[model samples]
Target: MLVDLFDFALPPERIALRPAAPRDTARMLVVTPDALADRIVRDLPSQLRRGDLLVFNDTRVIPAQLEGTRGDARIGATLHKREGPRRWRAFVRNARRLRDGDLIDFGAGVAAAARDRADDGSWALEFAGDEPVELLLERAGRMPLPPYIAGKRATDARDADDYQTMFANEPGAVAAPTAALHFTPDLLAALAAAGVDHATLTLHVGAGTFLPVKADDTADHRMHAEWGRIDAATAERLNTVRAAGGRVIAVGTTSLRLIESAAGDDGVIRPFEGDTAIFITPGYRFRGIDGLMTNFHLPRSTLFMLVSALMGLERMQAAYAHAITRDYRFYSYGDASLLLP
Candidate 1:
């Protein structure tokens, strides 16, 4: 399909620069097959059934944005993927100034040697340190905010907490699963009291999620691989939910993609531990999840394509139109959308 088909006009003011206070206060636009309703994220319990399970991505966001210098040239790097304990694949801001084998010095003695440059323009970076690379990042890195928000303002101490979800534990992700940011402890307790069971999976979201789809067609767009894991116990529990005739509600696109990647043709989810570069587009059949809760996405983005695939393209287009007209927020620090097809 033509990528232009997913394009929509969004007013710049509608993009949220900051998240709603009391997280759950964010507006949620519920898009169902037959109806569209405006609701609050706190009203999730009333929207879902008792037996339904909400799967959340537990991958924690790491401080991955680094600004440094090599000689006189200023360089910026955002680590996208972990190649080894000390090696990472990063997208460079000023690629023209760096070369393979160039030593870029990130202040505080944190530096890395640029290795192979991939065809996509990202460079393989090998960090120099005996201490864990996580420690090095703590000293030199800042939270990797989505460019939509970061471009408008600088990342601050507030974003350190705002960009992460309450379920964040296993650290690796460069980006937070934005949809899950609406959840809070009070919301979780309310959900449990409302009989909504929840589970967790890990998908280390990379900076690739912020990349624009420059392709003219959906077929030409390539998705970056992200590491994810689903344990046997969790898979068995999810299967049991399906067996009991309960719906599996994915809390974010990250969770949805990982679960779908683990599901078989027969629709049974199995234990999985590896990388997934699953690119969901229209005409794709979903097997694992019954519904999705995610943030409003960018125009012509892979995430919009995923939602278009979940619901029909026309329906999502209409839904987005309604969202825009209703003054709902957009992007990572934006409002939420509950999509059920």
Candidate 2:
């Protein structure tokens, strides 16, 4: 499919710079086959069925954005994936100034040597110290906000909490699974009260999620690999959910992609632990998830294409048009959408 088929115009003001004050108060657009309904995130319990299970991504966002200098040239790095305990793959800004073995100092005694540039132009950065890289990032790094938001304003201390979800525990993701950001302890209680169960898996969302589909056709595009894990117990439980006539609704695209990656042609989900570069587009068959809860995505993005694959492309286009006219927020720190095909 031509990438232009997924394109749409979005007003700049529609981008959310901050989250809703209470988080759950953010608007949610419920897109079903028949109609679209406007609701709030707090209304999720009422929207989903009693036997449905919502799968959440437990991967937590780290302070991965770094600004440093190599000689006289200023450089920026956003750690996207963990290659090892002391090594990470990062997208470099001002990368032309970097060499294979040159050391870039990120201040507060944090420095890394760059090497192994990939075809995507990202590099492997090996830290210089014996201390944990997490500790080093805590000292020298700030939240890696999406460029759409960061371009408008600065990343502040508030982002340290706002960007994370209630289910965030396993630390590794550069980007938060924003769909789960609307979930709070109170909301979870309501969901449980409504007999809606929840489970978690880890998919460390990378900065590559924010990268554009530079290819003109969907067939020519390649997705960046992100590490994810689903344990045997969790896999068994998810399969049981579907077998028992319960719906398995993924809370975000990250969860959905990982679930799909773990599922077989027969639609049985299995234990998985590794990198997934699954690129979901229209005409793709969904074997694992019954529904999805995600944010409004960028125009012509792979995410939008994924949602189009879940629901029909034309249906999603209409739904997005409805969302825009309704004044719904967009992107990370934005409103939500519950898509049921």
Cα distance off (Å), candidate 2, residue 225: 0.3
Off-target runs (Cα >4 Å) in candidate 2 are none
Instruction: Give one digit per residue, the lDDT tens place, for model 1 in 254-316.
Output: 999999999999999999999999999999989999999999999999999999999999999
For candidate 1, what is the TM-score? 0.99
Give the per-residue lDDT digits (tens) of candidate 2, residues 1-341.
99999999999999999999799999999999989999999999999888899999999999999999999999999999999989999999999999899999999999999989988899999999899999999999999999999999999989999999999999999999999999999999999999899999999999999999899999999888999999999999999999999899999999999999999999999999999999999889999999999999999999999999999999999999999999999999999999999
Error of 1 at 47 (Å): 0.5
Q: Each model's TM-score?
A: 0.99, 0.99
Cand. 2 Cα-lDDT: 0.96
User: Which ten contiguous residues of candidate 1 have the minimum total lDDT?
Assistant: 92-101
Which residue pairs in candidate 2 collide? none
lDDT of each: 0.95, 0.96
Off by over 4 Å in 1: none
Measured by TM-score, how close is model 2 to the native structure? 0.99
